[model samples]
Target: MRLAVLKERRPAETRVAATPETVKKYKALGLAVAVEAGAGLKAGVTDAAFAEAGAEVAPDAKAALDGADIVLKVRAPLAAGEGEVDELAMLPRGALLLGQLGTEHAGAFAERGVDAGSMELLPRITRAQSMDILSSQANLAGYRAVVEAAAAFDRGFPMLMTAAGTVPAANVFVMGAGVAGLQAIATARRLGGRVSATDVRPAAKEEIKSLGAAFIGHEDEESRAAQTAGGYAKPMSAAFLAKQAEVVADAIKKFDIVVCTALVQGRKAPTLVSQPMVESMKPGSVIVDLAADAGGNCAMTKPGEMVTTPNGVRVLGYTNWPGRIPAASSALYARNLLTFLTTFWDKEAGAPKLPPEDEIVRGVMLTRGGQVVHPSLQQQAKAA
Candidate 1:
């Protein structure tokens, strides 16, 4: 089978789907790889490195996608991206397209009759941890989010003590103690900041404190068990939210930096930080919303833009936090694609033979055999 890794056409996307190290893995599986020239350059993998791993360098985008049995990528093809929708038009019937799907255009891709699979849909089963691209990438976003906030802040993160003066450590508050939020707590703590994190899931309190962060949220026994088996946050009751907000609002006033990372799977992000909440912060504070692409957790955030209020508080809604750390992000995501791609026994019988009952396949298979294969997407198509 031929597998092609094309250079990402999206302007801000810096991650490539295949790295030189993983190219060798594909080679061992008897897969021929045609990597677009310089596809791994931004992620620190040179073309020569890919060549060393037994991949031929394609001259341009067309050659990269042509005659390939599978395509790997970071983002889905949008109508606007060069050679994006173009790939959709040219993909051979029954060919597989796998990558992260932006929530907005997911249905459109299904409508186009492409056999696309969404990487973000990978399940949280024990066997799939190595292939959990969302968690792997979120780990980087959480760490970088704090750094971005510190850079935007006028005050320093750590406490400073010199003969001339004694400076206090900045108070950092993190909303939503999921994978991203917990990492944010660890990052802020490592930077010598006093960190406190909150989440609707009551189970996260211990995880927060284990990272040396104060946990702030309702602790009722019922609320304490709010985590879903998949390790995601369940929406809290209105009464619970009202009480939790009270506990958080006071702490929010004291923090110098606030990181908002709350998200509900497959739904718009619930608003956690209200307009008045932003106004309550001290002057010169910074807020980085990791959930900005999902309509934002902060009421004032605008996706892909930054804003400041008249009171001197800064809110950054930059959407591509993972792109900021492209080299590492690409390496992890490439391994995920490799895991999903190499999950079959070709001994029999079929060129693209797969174990149909595989957890990863069932989780992400959006379309196959030219029919809408994902139940959620199929339901949406009916509603449309």
Candidate 2:
């Protein structure tokens, strides 16, 4: 089987799907690895490094993908426009493409007879944890959010005592207690900041407290059922959101930094910080919204840009937080894809044999047999 790694075309996407370390592993698995000339350049991997790992370096995406059995990418294939060739058109029919291909692009891949496997749809089961791209990437996003917030704020993170005077530690509030939010709380605490967090899920309360952050959320029936079995947040009612907003509005006033990571699966991110809430915050305070790409958890957020409000609060809304630390992000993400491949590799077939009965395989496989066959996409098609 020939595995090809293509260059990322998204404007802010600096991370690549494969690294030299993973390319070597692919070769050992009896797969021919071909990478675009500058595929890993932004992620700190040079063409020489990939060549040293015994992989072929193609001149461009078209050459790299020609006759390839499997294609790995950081994002979904780009459509023709904005100085980019239509990557989907170049893919060979019946080839498997794997990455963060969202539901919106399912129809295009199906029409081309390309079997698409979305890393975002990897099941949350224990056996599939190593291949969980969302958790791996979101963990870095959470840590980076705190780092960015600290830099944006004028005050220091840790307290100081000297002959001159005593400086109090900064206060940080993390809105959401998922994988990303928990890492933010931990990072804030590591920086000597007093951290607090809030989440609608009941399980998140213990997770927050365990990380030495105070949990702040009103307990109710709706809050108890806010988490799905797959460990993702479910959408909350308007009434619950209003009550939760009141609690956040009161607590946010005392914090020097706010990290918003709340997200509801398949829906726009719930607004946790209102414009009035931003106005209420003290001058020099900073807010980092990790959910900015999904419409943001703060009304003041300007996706992909940082802005300061009229009231003097800075809102950091860069969408690709992991890409800011590209080297580490690429390394971890490459390992995730490599692990997924190894787990599904078939010794007899010399290729990935995706078992239909396997929950993880079934969850991630978006299109097969020239149709949109993933359970979720099938349901979405029916609904449409």
Candidate 3:
């Protein structure tokens, strides 16, 4: 069996699926590895580095994917009209496709006769911790969000005393206390900022306080059940959201930096910061919206761009926060993919053997046998 790593064709995608470190591991599994030239360049891996790891470096996607039995990528392969090269069409039939392919591409993958495994759908179980790409990537994005916020803010993060005067610490407020939100709180605190965070989940209060950040949210009956069984945030009721917003609005006026990381799995991110709330904020404040790609938590946010309000408030809606720090992101992401593959490796066959009944395999497998087989996607299709 051969595994091919293709260069990401999605615009603004800087991370690659495979790194030289993982390439060598894949080879040890008795599977040949082929990497497209310059595939890992954005993530600081060179063709020579891959070659030194005992992998073949092909000049293009066509040559790399030729006769490949498995394909790894950062994003889904683009269709004929989506990119300069038709990566989807180039893939050999019956090949196993694995990546962060979004839910939108299920039909395409089914039609292509490719068995697709979307790492984003990896179950949040103890055994699958090492293979959870969402956790790994979001952890990086969370740390980067604070760094970007600090850079854009005109004031210092920590309070400093000099002979001239005292510089007060910036007030950082993080919305949501998930993996990304907690990391943002920790990063902000490390930068010497006074941080506070809120989450719909009742359990998040302790997590936020443990990180030395104040917790602020409206808690009630709805809040008690605000988490899904998979440990993801559940969408709150309109009444609950309104009350939560009121509390956040009051706190945000005094906040110098606001990091929005709230996201409901399989749904659009809930709006936490409205335009009126943005206007209430002081001049020269900054907001970093991590949920920009799935619509924004802030009304003023413009995905992939920064907007400055007339009052001098800066709203950053940068998409692909993980891609902003490609080197670190790719390293963690590649390890996640390697971990997943090795966990299900069949030594006798010298290839991966995913049992259909396995929880992890069933959780990530979106399509098989030329059909969208995942139960979640199947239900979604029926509703549509």
RMSD of 1: 2.3
1-384, model 1: which lDDT tens digit per residue? 888887887767889999888999888877889998988888888999999999999987678778888788898764545544465665555667888964455555556656678889888888788888899899999998998998998977899998999889999999998888988999999999999888878678788999999888767865876778888877777888788778877678888899999998877898888888889988999999999988999999999888997778999998878888899899889988887766653735434554447777778877766666676776777898
Which has the better lDDT: candidate 2, or candidate 3? 3
Off by over 4 Å in 2: none
Runs in model 1 with CA error above 4 Å? 79-85, 102-113, 345-352, 381-384
Q: Looking at candidate 3, what is the lDDT of residue 285?
A: 99
Question: Backbone clash tally for model 3?
Answer: 0
Q: Estimate each model's TM-score.
A: 0.92, 0.98, 0.99
Model 2, 222-291: lDDT tens digits are: 8898889999988888899899988888888998999999998888999899999999999999999999
On lDDT, the stronger of 1 and 3 is 3
Please give the clash total of every predicted structure, in order.
Answer: 0, 0, 0
**Which is the better candidate, 1 or 3, if ranked by TM-score?**
3
- TM-score of the candidate numbered 1? 0.92
lDDT tens string, model 3, 1-384? 999999998999999999889998998888899999999898899999999999999999999999999999999999988979999998898999999998889889999999999999999999999989899889989999999999999999999999999999999999989999999999999999999999999799999999999998899989999888889988788888889989988889999999999999988888899999999999999999999999999999999999999888999999999999999999999999999999999899888889889999999998898999888988887999
Q: Please give the ranking of all candidate structures by TM-score, highest first, separated by commas.
A: 3, 2, 1
Top of the candidates by lDDT: 3
lDDT of each: 0.82, 0.92, 0.93
Quote the lDDT for 359 in model 3. Answer: 96
